[model samples]
Target: MPNSANLGHKKKVFDLFAQKVLVVVGKGGTGRTTVARVLAELGTKTGRRVAVIAGTSGTHFLAKEDPLLSFSSLEPGQVLISYLYEHGLGQLGKRLSSTGLASIISTAIPGIADLLVLAKIKQMERSDAADLIIFDAPASGHFLRLIATPKGLADIAAAGPLRKQSREVLEMLDDPTRLGVAFVTIAEETPVKESIETMKQLKKSSGIVPCALFINSVLPSIPGNEKVQDLSFLESTSPYYQAAKYMRTRSQSQKHYEAMAAKAFGLKPIEVPLVPTVELSEDDITYLADIVELQIRSKK
Candidate 1:
């Protein structure tokens, strides 16, 4: 029998995994892919089967590094084709794939491609393909459009298979137990501003709030009891002193943005330290994952 404490810990872990889909969203260059990969790594490391459905290209590289991870990218065109066949419209699917009709249809119906992708994700969830599925969604504007697709269609599509499918996807999006959004951003002016605004837009449009916020690439504070202002005293023409001064100033700026985000989101943002490397390796990802896991576990 599990002890009460152990049971509580398991419950916490289960709660995190219970949300079958985690959509990682942020501004472009805000490290959304890295955060998504970290979440995938955390799930697999915890012994849960995981899949990553990347909205952008080159993400399969993560899966290549981790044998336990499953990665796939959804091409809107292909997803539309597969969706038709799944509904017993095989001939139509083939015709569209071969001809320009697909483009015409996609262009004619706004959000059709995004809706189809959501449908595909919904299908994956129902099939239990993995214990957790991390969707590395497109950046701000695109992500807003993506999640809003189902609701948009449900309103316009009044009474048919289209309506039914749209409603179903909307249900998945609204169910907190089934879907979670992790918003990632760097502690810079534009990204921070965009992050808060996008999250508010997400809530207003979809009625789904983000489950977590991550401030990526945060610089560590300079050691010692010296105040931030005192760091200026060490300013010199030497490259080493210049580098130190730059880091201190940036670190101070990061703190200010982090606080601003925390206040707006009403949730303490998880700060991911900047890894001192040009290109992050698999081990760096794992190290970051461990930090996130530890923080989450501690919270529990």
Candidate 2:
């Protein structure tokens, strides 16, 4: 879609994460999870300790396999219900219940206590035990809310433990050395346009700019040759011929969109080809990894 050359000319965002944390975000179905998973695998391969966490349902696909990368899903413990049950009821239950009324209630509801403890364990597993945590976050619309939660909660709990927790999350967001966000998009009008808007909102709301823009499902340039011209001449031959022409035209349009987006963002777009099937096999992931390695090497 956009100009590959224009994207190629910009600085690589991976340079920013030489020894830091990175978070990938994008609209749904833009392959943000795949890119995040690949990055986690790459980090582990390079001898960096890596952990991948997902705040949405689709992220479970990444954890299904025995990852060369360490992985966890955050959805289980991210909700208000889960948070209250876990940290409030379970982990802090006995202590809070040390106050007679709380103790009597917690003791009475054994089922509630188990649920709370399980949730706390899950939350800690998602957030605390990672060297490089790759958060396969919720889609763009929900991501803004997710990032804003800390500040909102902090304002409400200015002098409590919740305030301290909020401060820690805020510090993670503000520390460039500790956290960075990546926005994945396709070389299409809707996704690219939304990605730009997401980046703007992220900066305005959280003071965090997306460090990278990944353009997925790029069509490689068709080689120039006499045969290609002959194929073009056959555009009116049949419906099949017309379909081929339409495909080429779409590719060209996508390239233009990608180039324009790159120029607007002042960042290089990481291009990933559109594979035919929806599900990617391990071999496919490995192939993609090779392409990523080349892109990174070229930057070096």
TM-score of each: 0.84, 0.76
lDDT to native, each model: 0.73, 0.62
Q: What is the lDDT of residue 121 in candidate 2?
A: 30
What is the RMSD of candidate 2?
Answer: 7.0
Deviation from native of the Cα of residue 159 in model 2, angstroms = 4.2
Query: What value does the lDDT take at residue 11 in candidate 1?
Result: 22
Q: What C-alpha lDDT, on a 0 to 100 scale, does residue 227 get in candidate 1?
A: 51
Cα RMSD (Å) per model?
Answer: 6.1, 7.0
* Predicted structure 2: lDDT: 0.62
Instruction: Give lDDT: candidate 2, residue 173.
Output: 66
Give per-residue CA lDDT, model 1, range 1-300, as digits (tens): 000111122222223576999888887788888888888888888788889888765554455455668889975666765666677877665645533655676667756666777777888999968889888885537546768554566754565577777778889998989998888999888888988887888788778878888889877666642353455556566665777668767776777788788778766577677888988888888888887776566655
